[model samples]
Target: MKILIIEDEIALQQSIAESLEKENFLVETAADYHSAVEKVFVYQYDCILLDIMLPKGSGLDILEELKKVGKAENVIIISAKDSLDDKLKGLELGADDYLTKPFHLAELNARVKAVLRRKNQQGKNTIELRNTVLDLNERQFFVNDKNIPLNRKEFDILNYFLLNKKRLVTKTGLAEHVWGDNSDQADNLDFVYYQIKNLRKKLQEAQAEIEIESTYGIGYKLIEK
Candidate 1:
């Protein structure tokens, strides 16, 4: 999954980004409101960690903008303020959950997983599509009740494809979603093709019901076989 951390505190923001990245999530960060706004308008994320107090812009305003654009990214407000009004306002503005500062990182991680489960897997621990079942908690994949071994990148790629099944996924988007911001430094996306090829082989060997189709000059799409 991809996550954006909109926080003005550089240390806290980096910590959160590192934590999420360790959990195999692609993480991007914005230190101020303008950068956050720019990121939201330019890219898509599975979830957003929004800090209400920002430099030069309020997180509430960002939330309002998200609502206006109809971006359905699940947001969790992390603010130092513990007031009910703040919580209520954030919730009313479409935040999935709220976490106060001085909270444990473990708690934050759990909440993030819970929100993702609710948003992507309908509050279930597993994601099922066709004959494939992904155990979100365990990070395991099963096809026809048999476990399919996949490397980390392969799993990430497959999970991304499942999350956006049938949608046209660009090579750049796929790269960024898995490799994070570092993908931008690459001169070519030929590595993406290699990953896809390996993943396809695994799926074919397992007789999986889904397939990843190339869109000529565009990217790839996940479809049922």
Candidate 2:
């Protein structure tokens, strides 16, 4: 999963980013409001860790902007304030959960997982479509109950495909989600093409009931056989 951390405290932001990265999530950060707004406008994330307090603006405003634009990333409000109003206001603006400062990173991770489960995975740890299963926690994939081992990028791409099954996945969106947004600096996405080709070959060899269909010069979609 991809996560965006909107925080101004340098140490805390770095700590949270490092923790999520260790958890094998693609992590991105913005210390202030404008950059955070820009990111939400451009990219989609599985979840967003938002701080109530931000430089040049408040995180609540950011939530409002996201709603206005129809961005549905699960949001977890992280703040030092313990006020009920602040919590209520955030929830009203579409936050999935709130965490006060001086809390454990483990707890934060648990909350993130819970929100992702409830919203994205329908409260399940495994995603199943036809005969294929993608295990979120174990980072495993199975075809007809047989293990289909995958490297990190391949797994990420497959996960995204299953999550969006049958929906057109643009190349830019795929690159940004599986690779970091910074990957756009590369000269080409030949790397992405190679990865998809390799993964598709594996699925076919396994006789899996799913196929990744490509739209020439556009994108790809996951379809069941």
Candidate 3:
């Protein structure tokens, strides 16, 4: 999953980013209100961790802007304010959940998973595509009731495609999502080609009939047969 973290505290922001990255999530961060607004306007995210207090503006304003524009991005408010009015207001403004400051990273992680489940996965940990089932918690794939082995990158690629099924994902988008922003400076996208090829082979070998169609000059799309 891809996440946008809007927090002003540099230390806490980096910590949250690192922890989410370790869970195999594509994480992007914004340190202040304007940057956060720009990112939300430009890119899509599965979820957003928004801080109630920001350097230039309040996170509530950001949430209000999103709602004004009809953006359905799932938002979880992370704030130091524990007032009932604050919580109610956030929820009223379409915040999916709220977590106070000084909470455990593990707890935050669990809440993230919960919100993702409720928002994207239909409150389930497993995602069922046409011929495959993906166990998000275990990072495993099953086909025809049998487990299929996939390397980390292969799994990441497959999971990303599955999550974005039927969407035309550009090569640049895939590279940035899977390999991070540093991929933009690479000399070649051979790594992406290799990973997609490997993932295709693994699924085919597992008797899964899914296919990824290359868009020639564009990117790829997972097509269900």
Q: What are the Cα lDDT values of the candidates?
A: 0.83, 0.84, 0.81
For candidate 2, the per-residue lDDT at 96 reads: 77
lDDT tens per residue, model 1, 70-127? 8745998888744557767878878987777755565567567757866865667777
Decoy 3 TM-score against native: 0.54
Q: How close to the true structure is residue 212 of candidate 1, measured as C-alpha lDDT?
A: 96
Model 2, which residues run further than 4 Å from truth? 1-56, 60-73, 76-120
The number of clashing residue pairs in model 3 is 0
- Model 1 residue runs over 4 Å out of place are 1-55, 58-73, 76-120
Task: Please provide, for model 3 over 55-125, each residue's C-alpha lDDT reduced to its tens digit, 9 standing for 90 to 100.
Answer: 88988999988888877458988887345477668889999777767666755775677567657555678
Candidate 2 local lDDT, 1-225, one digit each (tens) = 999999999999999999889879999999999999999889889999999889999999999888887764599988874455777788888887777776667557756765676585556889888899999899999999999999999998998787667767767667755774355577988888999999999999999999999999978989999
**How accurate locally is residue 37 in candidate 2, as Cα lDDT from 0 to 100?**
90
Give the range where candidate 3 is weakest over 10 consecutive residues by summed lDDT. Answer: 175-184
Question: In model 1, which residue pairs have backbone atoms overlapping below 3 Å?
Answer: none
